[model samples]
Target: MEALGGLPEEAVVNSHVLQFYFHQALAAYRAGRNRDFRQFRDVMQALLVRPLEKDHIMARRLRLMQFLSRVEEGENLDCTFDKESDLTPLESAIGVLELIHTEFAVTQETMETLREMVKEAAVIVCIRNREFEKAAEIVKRHIGKEPKSQVSLCWNERQLLEHCLVCPMGCWGTEVPGVVSGMSYRVGSMTPEGVRGFLEKHAH
Candidate 1:
Protein backbone atom coordinates (compact mmCIF):
# COMPACT_ATOMS: atom_id res chain seq x y z
CA MET A 1 0.00 0.00 0.00
CA GLU A 2 2.86 2.39 0.90
CA ALA A 3 4.62 1.65 -2.36
CA LEU A 4 1.40 2.23 -4.32
CA GLY A 5 0.81 5.46 -2.42
CA GLY A 6 4.16 6.76 -3.63
CA LEU A 7 2.97 6.64 -7.22
CA PRO A 8 1.79 9.91 -8.82
CA GLU A 9 -1.98 10.54 -8.89
CA GLU A 10 -1.82 10.13 -12.65
CA ALA A 11 -0.73 6.51 -12.18
CA VAL A 12 -3.84 5.66 -10.19
CA VAL A 13 -5.81 4.94 -13.35
CA ASN A 14 -3.23 2.48 -14.67
CA SER A 15 -4.82 -0.87 -15.54
CA HIS A 16 -2.35 -2.68 -13.29
CA VAL A 17 -3.35 -0.56 -10.31
CA LEU A 18 -7.00 -1.13 -11.10
CA GLN A 19 -6.50 -4.90 -11.23
CA PHE A 20 -4.45 -4.79 -8.03
CA TYR A 21 -7.16 -2.91 -6.17
CA PHE A 22 -9.89 -5.21 -7.51
CA HIS A 23 -8.02 -8.37 -6.53
CA GLN A 24 -7.18 -6.91 -3.12
CA ALA A 25 -10.84 -6.03 -2.61
CA LEU A 26 -11.91 -9.56 -3.59
CA ALA A 27 -9.33 -11.08 -1.24
CA ALA A 28 -10.46 -8.85 1.59
CA TYR A 29 -14.11 -9.75 0.89
CA ARG A 30 -13.40 -13.50 0.93
CA ALA A 31 -11.43 -13.12 4.17
CA GLY A 32 -14.31 -11.22 5.85
CA ARG A 33 -12.16 -8.12 6.25
CA ASN A 34 -15.04 -5.69 5.73
CA ARG A 35 -13.18 -2.41 6.18
CA ASP A 36 -10.23 -3.49 4.05
CA PHE A 37 -12.62 -4.80 1.38
CA ARG A 38 -14.51 -1.51 1.35
CA GLN A 39 -11.30 0.52 1.09
CA PHE A 40 -9.93 -1.55 -1.77
CA ARG A 41 -13.34 -1.77 -3.45
CA ASP A 42 -13.78 2.00 -3.31
CA VAL A 43 -10.38 2.43 -4.95
CA MET A 44 -11.32 -0.11 -7.61
CA GLN A 45 -14.62 1.69 -8.21
CA ALA A 46 -12.79 5.00 -8.65
CA LEU A 47 -10.42 3.40 -11.13
CA LEU A 48 -13.28 1.92 -13.14
CA VAL A 49 -15.22 5.17 -13.18
CA ARG A 50 -15.95 8.28 -11.13
CA PRO A 51 -17.36 6.97 -7.83
CA LEU A 52 -20.23 8.48 -5.84
CA GLU A 53 -21.22 10.67 -8.75
CA LYS A 54 -25.03 10.46 -8.56
CA ASP A 55 -25.48 11.00 -12.27
CA HIS A 56 -23.42 7.90 -13.12
CA ILE A 57 -25.08 4.50 -12.83
CA MET A 58 -21.82 2.86 -11.70
CA ALA A 59 -21.44 5.42 -8.94
CA ARG A 60 -24.99 4.80 -7.71
CA ARG A 61 -24.35 1.06 -7.71
CA LEU A 62 -21.14 1.51 -5.73
CA ARG A 63 -23.02 3.62 -3.20
CA LEU A 64 -25.60 0.87 -2.95
CA MET A 65 -22.83 -1.66 -2.26
CA GLN A 66 -21.53 0.47 0.61
CA PHE A 67 -24.94 0.19 2.25
CA LEU A 68 -25.18 -3.53 1.52
CA SER A 69 -21.73 -4.25 2.99
CA ARG A 70 -22.88 -2.81 6.30
CA VAL A 71 -26.06 -4.90 6.26
CA GLU A 72 -24.07 -8.05 5.44
CA GLU A 73 -21.84 -7.42 8.46
CA GLY A 74 -24.92 -7.55 10.75
CA GLU A 75 -25.02 -3.81 11.12
CA ASN A 76 -28.36 -2.07 11.77
CA LEU A 77 -27.63 0.74 9.34
CA ASP A 78 -30.50 2.24 7.40
CA CYS A 79 -30.30 1.63 3.64
CA THR A 80 -31.67 4.64 1.78
CA PHE A 81 -31.05 3.91 -1.91
CA ASP A 82 -33.41 4.67 -4.78
CA LYS A 83 -36.24 2.16 -4.66
CA GLU A 84 -37.56 0.48 -7.76
CA SER A 85 -41.22 0.99 -8.68
CA ASP A 86 -43.53 -0.91 -6.31
CA LEU A 87 -40.68 -3.11 -5.05
CA THR A 88 -40.21 -4.03 -1.42
CA PRO A 89 -36.91 -3.49 0.36
CA LEU A 90 -35.77 -7.10 -0.04
CA GLU A 91 -36.88 -7.17 -3.68
CA SER A 92 -35.02 -3.95 -4.42
CA ALA A 93 -31.88 -5.39 -2.83
CA ILE A 94 -32.19 -8.52 -4.97
CA GLY A 95 -32.66 -6.40 -8.08
CA VAL A 96 -29.46 -4.50 -7.33
CA LEU A 97 -27.56 -7.72 -6.72
CA GLU A 98 -28.73 -9.05 -10.08
CA LEU A 99 -27.88 -5.76 -11.79
CA ILE A 100 -24.42 -5.73 -10.28
CA HIS A 101 -23.90 -9.35 -11.24
CA THR A 102 -24.65 -8.43 -14.83
CA GLU A 103 -22.51 -5.27 -14.84
CA PHE A 104 -19.40 -6.50 -12.99
CA ALA A 105 -16.73 -8.68 -14.60
CA VAL A 106 -16.45 -11.03 -11.67
CA THR A 107 -15.31 -14.64 -11.66
CA GLN A 108 -17.75 -17.53 -11.58
CA GLU A 109 -17.03 -18.13 -7.90
CA THR A 110 -17.54 -14.49 -6.90
CA MET A 111 -20.73 -14.28 -8.93
CA GLU A 112 -22.01 -17.48 -7.31
CA THR A 113 -21.16 -16.09 -3.89
CA LEU A 114 -23.22 -12.97 -4.48
CA ARG A 115 -26.04 -15.00 -5.99
CA GLU A 116 -26.14 -17.27 -2.97
CA MET A 117 -26.18 -14.28 -0.66
CA VAL A 118 -29.21 -12.78 -2.38
CA LYS A 119 -30.96 -16.16 -2.60
CA GLU A 120 -30.50 -16.75 1.10
CA ALA A 121 -31.67 -13.24 1.87
CA ALA A 122 -34.77 -13.77 -0.26
CA VAL A 123 -35.56 -17.01 1.53
CA ILE A 124 -35.24 -15.31 4.90
CA VAL A 125 -37.57 -12.57 3.80
CA CYS A 126 -40.06 -15.10 2.54
CA ILE A 127 -39.94 -17.06 5.77
CA ARG A 128 -40.42 -13.88 7.80
CA ASN A 129 -43.43 -12.95 5.74
CA ARG A 130 -45.00 -16.37 6.43
CA GLU A 131 -44.48 -17.33 2.82
CA PHE A 132 -42.80 -20.59 3.77
CA GLU A 133 -43.75 -22.30 0.49
CA LYS A 134 -42.10 -19.53 -1.47
CA ALA A 135 -38.91 -19.90 0.52
CA ALA A 136 -38.83 -23.65 -0.13
CA GLU A 137 -39.38 -23.04 -3.84
CA ILE A 138 -36.51 -20.57 -3.95
CA VAL A 139 -34.24 -23.11 -2.27
CA LYS A 140 -35.38 -25.91 -4.56
CA ARG A 141 -34.97 -23.91 -7.77
CA HIS A 142 -31.31 -23.04 -7.25
CA ILE A 143 -30.07 -24.86 -4.14
CA GLY A 144 -31.03 -28.26 -5.63
CA LYS A 145 -32.67 -31.26 -3.97
CA GLU A 146 -29.53 -32.28 -2.08
CA PRO A 147 -29.04 -31.38 1.56
CA LYS A 148 -26.33 -28.78 1.88
CA SER A 149 -24.31 -28.13 5.01
CA GLN A 150 -23.76 -24.66 6.34
CA VAL A 151 -20.71 -22.92 4.88
CA SER A 152 -19.28 -19.42 5.07
CA LEU A 153 -22.13 -16.88 4.81
CA CYS A 154 -24.62 -19.76 4.68
CA TRP A 155 -27.47 -20.39 7.04
CA ASN A 156 -27.82 -23.85 8.64
CA GLU A 157 -31.31 -24.37 7.29
CA ARG A 158 -31.35 -28.14 7.70
CA GLN A 159 -30.49 -28.20 11.39
CA LEU A 160 -32.40 -25.00 12.01
CA LEU A 161 -35.65 -26.00 10.31
CA GLU A 162 -35.37 -29.54 11.66
CA HIS A 163 -35.15 -28.13 15.14
CA CYS A 164 -38.05 -25.87 14.37
CA LEU A 165 -40.07 -28.94 13.45
CA VAL A 166 -39.20 -30.57 16.77
CA CYS A 167 -40.62 -27.64 18.67
CA PRO A 168 -44.35 -27.02 19.30
CA MET A 169 -46.70 -26.40 16.43
CA GLY A 170 -46.59 -22.75 17.39
CA CYS A 171 -43.30 -22.33 15.56
CA TRP A 172 -43.22 -20.09 12.47
CA GLY A 173 -41.44 -22.29 9.90
CA THR A 174 -42.59 -25.80 10.74
CA GLU A 175 -44.74 -26.06 7.62
CA VAL A 176 -43.05 -25.49 4.27
CA PRO A 177 -39.50 -25.84 5.55
CA GLY A 178 -40.31 -29.37 6.64
CA VAL A 179 -42.48 -29.81 3.56
CA VAL A 180 -39.51 -29.16 1.25
CA SER A 181 -37.18 -31.54 3.10
CA GLY A 182 -35.21 -33.91 0.90
CA MET A 183 -36.29 -37.54 0.70
CA SER A 184 -32.74 -38.78 0.23
CA TYR A 185 -32.07 -41.70 2.59
CA ARG A 186 -28.91 -41.52 4.69
CA VAL A 187 -26.76 -44.69 4.83
CA GLY A 188 -25.00 -43.83 8.06
CA SER A 189 -25.72 -42.16 11.37
CA MET A 190 -22.10 -41.13 11.81
CA THR A 191 -19.75 -43.66 10.17
CA PRO A 192 -19.41 -46.13 7.31
CA GLU A 193 -19.12 -49.05 9.75
CA GLY A 194 -22.49 -48.21 11.25
CA VAL A 195 -24.00 -48.02 7.79
CA ARG A 196 -22.39 -51.30 6.75
CA GLY A 197 -23.63 -53.11 9.86
CA PHE A 198 -27.14 -51.75 9.41
CA LEU A 199 -27.13 -52.68 5.73
CA GLU A 200 -25.82 -56.18 6.51
CA LYS A 201 -28.53 -56.70 9.12
CA HIS A 202 -31.21 -55.40 6.79
CA ALA A 203 -29.93 -57.53 3.91
CA HIS A 204 -30.55 -60.70 5.95
Candidate 2:
Protein backbone atom coordinates (compact mmCIF):
# COMPACT_ATOMS: atom_id res chain seq x y z
CA MET A 1 0.00 0.00 0.00
CA GLU A 2 2.87 2.37 0.81
CA ALA A 3 4.37 1.73 -2.58
CA LEU A 4 1.00 2.32 -4.20
CA GLY A 5 1.07 5.82 -2.74
CA GLY A 6 4.13 6.59 -4.93
CA LEU A 7 2.28 5.61 -8.12
CA PRO A 8 1.03 8.12 -10.71
CA GLU A 9 -2.22 9.94 -9.87
CA GLU A 10 -4.18 8.21 -12.62
CA ALA A 11 -3.04 4.79 -11.52
CA VAL A 12 -3.91 5.46 -7.88
CA VAL A 13 -7.38 6.75 -8.73
CA ASN A 14 -8.06 3.69 -10.88
CA SER A 15 -6.99 1.26 -8.18
CA HIS A 16 -9.01 -0.54 -5.48
CA VAL A 17 -6.75 0.73 -2.71
CA LEU A 18 -9.23 3.35 -1.53
CA GLN A 19 -12.00 0.76 -1.34
CA PHE A 20 -9.81 -1.41 0.84
CA TYR A 21 -9.20 1.50 3.20
CA PHE A 22 -12.92 2.27 3.26
CA HIS A 23 -13.74 -1.29 4.29
CA GLN A 24 -11.12 -1.12 7.02
CA ALA A 25 -12.63 2.10 8.33
CA LEU A 26 -16.10 0.61 8.31
CA ALA A 27 -14.87 -2.49 10.10
CA ALA A 28 -13.22 -0.41 12.78
CA TYR A 29 -16.39 1.61 13.26
CA ARG A 30 -18.50 -1.54 13.55
CA ALA A 31 -16.10 -3.08 16.05
CA GLY A 32 -16.24 0.04 18.24
CA ARG A 33 -12.52 0.72 18.01
CA ASN A 34 -12.45 4.51 18.05
CA ARG A 35 -8.73 4.87 17.49
CA ASP A 36 -8.62 2.48 14.55
CA PHE A 37 -11.76 4.03 13.10
CA ARG A 38 -10.26 7.51 13.13
CA GLN A 39 -7.06 6.31 11.51
CA PHE A 40 -8.85 4.55 8.68
CA ARG A 41 -11.32 7.38 8.24
CA ASP A 42 -8.39 9.76 7.79
CA VAL A 43 -6.87 7.50 5.18
CA MET A 44 -10.08 7.18 3.18
CA GLN A 45 -10.77 10.89 3.42
CA ALA A 46 -7.32 11.71 2.15
CA LEU A 47 -7.86 9.58 -0.90
CA LEU A 48 -11.34 10.92 -1.48
CA VAL A 49 -10.12 14.51 -1.49
CA ARG A 50 -8.22 13.83 -4.67
CA PRO A 51 -9.61 14.35 -8.17
CA LEU A 52 -11.79 11.42 -9.18
CA GLU A 53 -14.45 10.92 -11.83
CA LYS A 54 -17.79 12.26 -10.66
CA ASP A 55 -19.61 9.12 -11.83
CA HIS A 56 -17.20 6.73 -10.19
CA ILE A 57 -18.98 4.29 -7.88
CA MET A 58 -16.16 4.29 -5.38
CA ALA A 59 -16.23 8.07 -5.15
CA ARG A 60 -19.96 8.06 -4.52
CA ARG A 61 -19.59 5.33 -1.94
CA LEU A 62 -16.86 7.23 -0.14
CA ARG A 63 -18.95 10.37 -0.08
CA LEU A 64 -21.86 8.46 1.40
CA MET A 65 -19.59 6.91 3.99
CA GLN A 66 -18.17 10.27 4.98
CA PHE A 67 -21.66 11.73 5.30
CA LEU A 68 -22.80 8.88 7.50
CA SER A 69 -19.68 9.20 9.61
CA ARG A 70 -20.40 12.89 10.21
CA VAL A 71 -23.96 12.08 11.16
CA GLU A 72 -22.74 9.48 13.64
CA GLU A 73 -20.21 11.89 15.09
CA GLY A 74 -22.97 14.46 15.55
CA GLU A 75 -25.19 11.98 17.29
CA ASN A 76 -22.39 10.87 19.57
CA LEU A 77 -21.66 14.45 20.52
CA ASP A 78 -25.33 15.14 21.12
CA CYS A 79 -25.53 12.21 23.55
CA THR A 80 -22.17 12.26 25.31
CA PHE A 81 -20.10 15.37 24.74
CA ASP A 82 -20.03 18.57 26.74
CA LYS A 83 -22.43 21.14 25.38
CA GLU A 84 -19.88 23.90 25.75
CA SER A 85 -17.22 22.37 23.53
CA ASP A 86 -18.92 19.90 21.22
CA LEU A 87 -19.37 20.91 17.58
CA THR A 88 -22.81 20.84 15.97
CA PRO A 89 -23.36 17.57 14.13
CA LEU A 90 -26.31 18.87 12.15
CA GLU A 91 -24.10 21.55 10.64
CA SER A 92 -21.68 18.91 9.45
CA ALA A 93 -24.53 16.83 8.07
CA ILE A 94 -25.92 19.78 6.17
CA GLY A 95 -22.48 20.58 4.82
CA VAL A 96 -22.15 17.06 3.46
CA LEU A 97 -25.53 17.31 1.75
CA GLU A 98 -24.48 20.52 0.07
CA LEU A 99 -21.26 18.96 -1.15
CA ILE A 100 -23.08 15.93 -2.53
CA HIS A 101 -25.63 18.09 -4.26
CA THR A 102 -23.10 20.31 -6.01
CA GLU A 103 -20.39 17.76 -6.79
CA PHE A 104 -22.37 14.65 -7.70
CA ALA A 105 -24.67 13.91 -10.63
CA VAL A 106 -27.34 12.02 -8.71
CA THR A 107 -30.86 11.81 -10.11
CA GLN A 108 -33.29 14.65 -9.44
CA GLU A 109 -35.47 12.48 -7.24
CA THR A 110 -32.49 11.39 -5.21
CA MET A 111 -31.35 14.99 -4.82
CA GLU A 112 -34.75 16.13 -3.60
CA THR A 113 -34.96 13.27 -1.16
CA LEU A 114 -31.51 14.04 0.17
CA ARG A 115 -32.45 17.71 0.59
CA GLU A 116 -35.60 16.82 2.48
CA MET A 117 -33.71 14.45 4.76
CA VAL A 118 -31.10 17.07 5.53
CA LYS A 119 -33.71 19.71 6.30
CA GLU A 120 -35.58 17.32 8.56
CA ALA A 121 -32.42 16.43 10.44
CA ALA A 122 -31.44 20.08 10.71
CA VAL A 123 -34.83 20.96 12.11
CA ILE A 124 -34.45 18.38 14.86
CA VAL A 125 -30.98 19.55 15.71
CA CYS A 126 -31.93 23.22 15.78
CA ILE A 127 -34.90 22.48 17.98
CA ARG A 128 -32.67 20.60 20.39
CA ASN A 129 -30.27 23.52 20.45
CA ARG A 130 -33.21 25.85 21.15
CA GLU A 131 -32.65 27.63 17.85
CA PHE A 132 -36.33 27.77 17.01
CA GLU A 133 -35.97 30.61 14.55
CA LYS A 134 -33.44 28.71 12.49
CA ALA A 135 -35.65 25.64 12.55
CA ALA A 136 -38.57 27.65 11.19
CA GLU A 137 -36.37 29.08 8.46
CA ILE A 138 -35.19 25.63 7.40
CA VAL A 139 -38.76 24.33 7.17
CA LYS A 140 -39.91 27.35 5.28
CA ARG A 141 -37.02 27.11 2.85
CA HIS A 142 -37.71 23.47 2.04
CA ILE A 143 -41.49 23.83 1.95
CA GLY A 144 -41.17 27.01 -0.14
CA LYS A 145 -42.91 30.37 0.15
CA GLU A 146 -46.24 29.16 -1.23
CA PRO A 147 -46.60 25.81 0.42
CA LYS A 148 -50.18 25.54 -0.77
CA SER A 149 -49.18 25.74 -4.41
CA GLN A 150 -45.50 24.87 -4.67
CA VAL A 151 -44.65 22.57 -1.80
CA SER A 152 -45.81 18.98 -2.05
CA LEU A 153 -44.87 17.30 1.17
CA CYS A 154 -45.30 13.74 2.32
CA TRP A 155 -47.15 12.95 5.56
CA ASN A 156 -43.94 12.45 7.49
CA GLU A 157 -42.47 15.66 6.10
CA ARG A 158 -45.67 17.53 6.85
CA GLN A 159 -45.68 16.27 10.40
CA LEU A 160 -42.03 17.22 10.78
CA LEU A 161 -42.70 20.71 9.44
CA GLU A 162 -45.65 21.13 11.73
CA HIS A 163 -43.56 20.02 14.66
CA CYS A 164 -40.85 22.45 13.69
CA LEU A 165 -43.31 25.34 13.44
CA VAL A 166 -44.88 24.75 16.83
CA CYS A 167 -42.61 22.77 19.09
CA PRO A 168 -40.95 25.03 21.66
CA MET A 169 -37.53 24.13 22.96
CA GLY A 170 -37.93 20.66 21.38
CA CYS A 171 -40.50 19.57 23.95
CA TRP A 172 -43.72 17.82 22.90
CA GLY A 173 -45.49 19.43 25.84
CA THR A 174 -46.68 16.77 28.25
CA GLU A 175 -48.88 19.00 30.42
CA VAL A 176 -46.61 22.00 30.37
CA PRO A 177 -48.28 25.35 30.89
CA GLY A 178 -49.21 27.19 27.65
CA VAL A 179 -48.41 24.04 25.69
CA VAL A 180 -52.00 23.24 24.88
CA SER A 181 -52.75 26.80 23.85
CA GLY A 182 -49.75 27.09 21.54
CA MET A 183 -50.26 23.67 20.02
CA SER A 184 -53.95 24.28 19.52
CA TYR A 185 -53.30 27.54 17.70
CA ARG A 186 -50.81 25.93 15.37
CA VAL A 187 -53.00 22.91 14.75
CA GLY A 188 -55.99 25.10 14.09
CA SER A 189 -54.06 27.03 11.49
CA MET A 190 -53.45 23.81 9.57
CA THR A 191 -56.71 22.91 7.85
CA PRO A 192 -57.72 19.65 6.18
CA GLU A 193 -57.58 21.40 2.80
CA GLY A 194 -54.02 22.50 3.45
CA VAL A 195 -52.96 18.98 4.25
CA ARG A 196 -54.85 17.70 1.22
CA GLY A 197 -53.01 20.16 -0.96
CA PHE A 198 -49.67 19.01 0.36
CA LEU A 199 -50.59 15.37 -0.05
CA GLU A 200 -51.89 15.88 -3.55
CA LYS A 201 -48.87 17.84 -4.62
CA HIS A 202 -46.46 15.20 -3.37
CA ALA A 203 -48.57 12.24 -4.50
CA HIS A 204 -46.99 12.31 -7.95
Candidate 3:
Protein backbone atom coordinates (compact mmCIF):
# COMPACT_ATOMS: atom_id res chain seq x y z
CA MET A 1 0.00 0.00 0.00
CA GLU A 2 2.81 2.40 0.94
CA ALA A 3 4.75 1.66 -2.26
CA LEU A 4 1.63 2.00 -4.45
CA GLY A 5 0.63 5.32 -2.91
CA GLY A 6 2.82 7.27 -5.32
CA LEU A 7 1.33 5.53 -8.34
CA PRO A 8 -1.59 6.92 -10.37
CA GLU A 9 -4.81 6.88 -8.35
CA GLU A 10 -6.72 5.02 -11.07
CA ALA A 11 -4.13 2.22 -11.14
CA VAL A 12 -4.18 1.86 -7.37
CA VAL A 13 -7.96 1.92 -7.21
CA ASN A 14 -8.32 -0.58 -10.06
CA SER A 15 -5.83 -2.98 -8.41
CA HIS A 16 -7.51 -2.90 -5.01
CA VAL A 17 -10.95 -3.15 -6.55
CA LEU A 18 -10.01 -6.23 -8.55
CA GLN A 19 -8.27 -7.79 -5.55
CA PHE A 20 -11.34 -7.27 -3.35
CA TYR A 21 -13.64 -8.60 -6.09
CA PHE A 22 -11.53 -11.74 -6.48
CA HIS A 23 -11.58 -12.33 -2.75
CA GLN A 24 -15.33 -11.99 -2.73
CA ALA A 25 -15.65 -14.44 -5.58
CA LEU A 26 -13.37 -16.93 -3.86
CA ALA A 27 -15.47 -16.68 -0.75
CA ALA A 28 -18.61 -17.20 -2.81
CA TYR A 29 -17.12 -20.22 -4.55
CA ARG A 30 -16.25 -21.81 -1.18
CA ALA A 31 -19.85 -21.25 -0.12
CA GLY A 32 -21.10 -22.92 -3.39
CA ARG A 33 -22.64 -19.79 -4.95
CA ASN A 34 -23.00 -20.34 -8.72
CA ARG A 35 -24.04 -16.72 -9.49
CA ASP A 36 -20.65 -15.29 -8.50
CA PHE A 37 -18.81 -17.73 -10.80
CA ARG A 38 -21.09 -16.89 -13.71
CA GLN A 39 -20.47 -13.18 -13.23
CA PHE A 40 -16.72 -13.72 -13.11
CA ARG A 41 -16.88 -15.82 -16.28
CA ASP A 42 -18.79 -13.04 -18.08
CA VAL A 43 -16.23 -10.45 -17.02
CA MET A 44 -13.39 -12.71 -18.23
CA GLN A 45 -14.99 -13.04 -21.66
CA ALA A 46 -15.29 -9.23 -22.02
CA LEU A 47 -11.63 -8.81 -21.03
CA LEU A 48 -10.56 -11.37 -23.62
CA VAL A 49 -12.37 -9.72 -26.54
CA ARG A 50 -11.95 -6.08 -25.53
CA PRO A 51 -8.30 -5.85 -26.53
CA LEU A 52 -9.00 -7.38 -29.94
CA GLU A 53 -10.72 -4.07 -30.83
CA LYS A 54 -7.55 -2.03 -30.15
CA ASP A 55 -5.33 -0.81 -33.01
CA HIS A 56 -2.12 -2.47 -31.73
CA ILE A 57 -3.95 -5.78 -31.36
CA MET A 58 -5.28 -5.42 -34.91
CA ALA A 59 -1.73 -4.72 -36.11
CA ARG A 60 -0.49 -7.93 -34.44
CA ARG A 61 -3.31 -9.91 -35.99
CA LEU A 62 -2.51 -8.40 -39.41
CA ARG A 63 1.16 -9.27 -39.00
CA LEU A 64 0.25 -12.90 -38.27
CA MET A 65 -1.87 -12.91 -41.38
CA GLN A 66 1.08 -11.59 -43.38
CA PHE A 67 3.30 -14.41 -42.06
CA LEU A 68 0.76 -17.01 -43.15
CA SER A 69 0.63 -15.37 -46.58
CA ARG A 70 4.40 -15.72 -47.06
CA VAL A 71 4.04 -19.44 -46.39
CA GLU A 72 1.55 -19.55 -49.25
CA GLU A 73 3.98 -17.66 -51.47
CA GLY A 74 6.51 -20.53 -51.19
CA GLU A 75 9.17 -18.07 -50.07
CA ASN A 76 11.99 -18.77 -47.63
CA LEU A 77 10.91 -16.11 -45.13
CA ASP A 78 13.21 -17.29 -42.34
CA CYS A 79 16.88 -16.38 -42.11
CA THR A 80 18.60 -16.21 -38.74
CA PHE A 81 18.25 -12.42 -38.48
CA ASP A 82 19.18 -10.53 -41.62
CA LYS A 83 21.14 -7.28 -41.40
CA GLU A 84 18.31 -6.11 -43.68
CA SER A 85 15.39 -5.05 -41.52
CA ASP A 86 15.14 -3.59 -38.01
CA LEU A 87 12.54 -6.29 -37.23
CA THR A 88 9.26 -4.41 -37.15
CA PRO A 89 5.98 -6.29 -36.53
CA LEU A 90 5.72 -7.23 -40.19
CA GLU A 91 9.33 -8.40 -40.31
CA SER A 92 8.82 -10.52 -37.20
CA ALA A 93 5.86 -12.12 -38.94
CA ILE A 94 7.94 -12.70 -42.04
CA GLY A 95 10.50 -14.39 -39.80
CA VAL A 96 7.84 -16.79 -38.51
CA LEU A 97 6.65 -17.50 -42.04
CA GLU A 98 10.25 -18.17 -43.03
CA LEU A 99 10.40 -20.82 -40.31
CA ILE A 100 7.21 -22.41 -41.63
CA HIS A 101 8.54 -22.28 -45.17
CA THR A 102 11.74 -24.00 -44.07
CA GLU A 103 9.94 -26.73 -42.14
CA PHE A 104 7.14 -27.54 -44.61
CA ALA A 105 8.71 -26.44 -47.89
CA VAL A 106 5.43 -25.71 -49.66
CA THR A 107 4.43 -27.30 -52.94
CA GLN A 108 2.13 -25.79 -55.59
CA GLU A 109 -0.97 -27.58 -54.23
CA THR A 110 -0.24 -26.95 -50.50
CA MET A 111 -0.69 -23.18 -50.64
CA GLU A 112 -4.40 -22.85 -51.41
CA THR A 113 -5.67 -22.49 -47.83
CA LEU A 114 -2.75 -20.30 -46.82
CA ARG A 115 -3.48 -18.01 -49.77
CA GLU A 116 -7.10 -17.69 -48.67
CA MET A 117 -6.05 -16.77 -45.12
CA VAL A 118 -3.81 -14.06 -46.54
CA LYS A 119 -6.65 -12.63 -48.62
CA GLU A 120 -8.96 -12.64 -45.61
CA ALA A 121 -6.38 -10.91 -43.46
CA ALA A 122 -5.81 -8.28 -46.11
CA VAL A 123 -9.52 -7.61 -46.20
CA ILE A 124 -9.57 -7.27 -42.42
CA VAL A 125 -6.74 -4.74 -42.48
CA CYS A 126 -8.45 -2.75 -45.21
CA ILE A 127 -11.64 -2.66 -43.18
CA ARG A 128 -9.70 -1.57 -40.11
CA ASN A 129 -8.00 1.14 -42.14
CA ARG A 130 -11.36 2.42 -43.31
CA GLU A 131 -12.63 2.51 -39.73
CA PHE A 132 -9.60 4.45 -38.59
CA GLU A 133 -9.98 6.92 -41.44
CA LYS A 134 -13.63 7.50 -40.56
CA ALA A 135 -12.74 8.01 -36.91
CA ALA A 136 -9.97 10.42 -37.87
CA GLU A 137 -12.34 12.40 -40.04
CA ILE A 138 -14.80 12.72 -37.16
CA VAL A 139 -12.07 13.86 -34.80
CA LYS A 140 -10.73 16.25 -37.40
CA ARG A 141 -14.13 17.90 -37.90
CA HIS A 142 -14.64 18.45 -34.18
CA ILE A 143 -11.08 19.27 -33.09
CA GLY A 144 -10.24 21.70 -35.93
CA LYS A 145 -7.84 20.58 -38.68
CA GLU A 146 -4.88 18.52 -37.47
CA PRO A 147 -1.32 19.69 -38.01
CA LYS A 148 0.67 18.15 -40.85
CA SER A 149 3.36 17.15 -38.36
CA GLN A 150 1.04 14.60 -36.62
CA VAL A 151 0.34 12.56 -39.75
CA SER A 152 2.21 9.24 -39.52
CA LEU A 153 1.60 8.25 -43.13
CA CYS A 154 1.32 10.34 -46.27
CA TRP A 155 2.82 9.17 -49.54
CA ASN A 156 5.88 11.24 -50.50
CA GLU A 157 9.48 10.58 -51.56
CA ARG A 158 11.36 10.87 -48.26
CA GLN A 159 8.56 9.28 -46.23
CA LEU A 160 8.38 6.49 -48.78
CA LEU A 161 12.11 5.90 -48.49
CA GLU A 162 12.05 5.77 -44.69
CA HIS A 163 9.18 3.27 -44.69
CA CYS A 164 10.53 1.10 -47.49
CA LEU A 165 14.01 0.59 -46.06
CA VAL A 166 12.68 -0.34 -42.64
CA CYS A 167 9.08 -1.52 -43.08
CA PRO A 168 8.29 -5.24 -43.08
CA MET A 169 6.62 -5.62 -46.49
CA GLY A 170 8.91 -2.76 -47.35
CA CYS A 171 5.70 -0.66 -47.18
CA TRP A 172 4.45 -0.27 -50.79
CA GLY A 173 6.94 -2.49 -52.60
CA THR A 174 5.90 -6.19 -52.75
CA GLU A 175 2.40 -5.59 -51.42
CA VAL A 176 1.32 -3.31 -54.30
CA PRO A 177 0.38 -6.15 -56.62
CA GLY A 178 -2.39 -7.62 -54.50
CA VAL A 179 -4.04 -4.55 -52.99
CA VAL A 180 -2.72 -1.71 -55.10
CA SER A 181 -2.28 -3.05 -58.64
CA GLY A 182 -4.96 -5.75 -58.22
CA MET A 183 -2.58 -8.38 -59.51
CA SER A 184 -1.76 -11.46 -57.48
CA TYR A 185 1.42 -13.30 -58.35
CA ARG A 186 3.92 -14.80 -55.97
CA VAL A 187 6.28 -11.82 -55.77
CA GLY A 188 8.78 -11.20 -52.96
CA SER A 189 11.40 -9.47 -55.09
CA MET A 190 9.74 -6.05 -55.41
CA THR A 191 10.03 -5.20 -51.74
CA PRO A 192 9.34 -1.62 -50.56
CA GLU A 193 13.09 -1.14 -50.11
CA GLY A 194 13.70 -2.23 -53.68
CA VAL A 195 11.08 0.17 -55.04
CA ARG A 196 12.49 3.10 -53.04
CA GLY A 197 15.99 2.35 -54.31
CA PHE A 198 14.64 2.17 -57.85
CA LEU A 199 13.05 5.63 -57.56
CA GLU A 200 16.10 7.18 -55.93
CA LYS A 201 18.41 5.66 -58.54
CA HIS A 202 16.24 6.85 -61.42
CA ALA A 203 15.53 10.33 -60.00
CA HIS A 204 18.98 11.42 -61.15
| Number of clashes recorded per candidate | 0, 0, 2
lDDT of 3 at 192: 25
Per-residue alpha-carbon lDDT of model 1 for 1-204, expressed as tens digits? Answer: 223546544554455565566456545554556779768766765665532212343343453444344334322112333444433344445556566556544455655555555555545554444454545555555454534653322245554333333442325545554533432212111112422232233221
lDDT tens digits by residue: candidate 2, 94-142: 5666777776655567556555554455555554445656666666655
Look at candidate 3 and give me any clashing residue pairs: 77-98, 78-98
* Local distance difference test, candidate 3: 0.35
TM-score of each: 0.36, 0.47, 0.20
**What's model 2's lDDT at 177?**
30
Greater TM-score among 2 and 3 belongs to 2
CA lDDT scores, all candidates in order: 0.45, 0.53, 0.35
Can you write out model 3's per-residue Cα lDDT over 1-204, one digit (the tens) per residue? 323436555545544444444445334433445467446534533434332223443333333333423322222233323466633222344455445444443543334333333332322232233322322222333212434443323243223323333442433556443433332322232222322232232221
RMSD of each: 14.4, 10.7, 21.1
Ranking by lDDT: 2, 1, 3
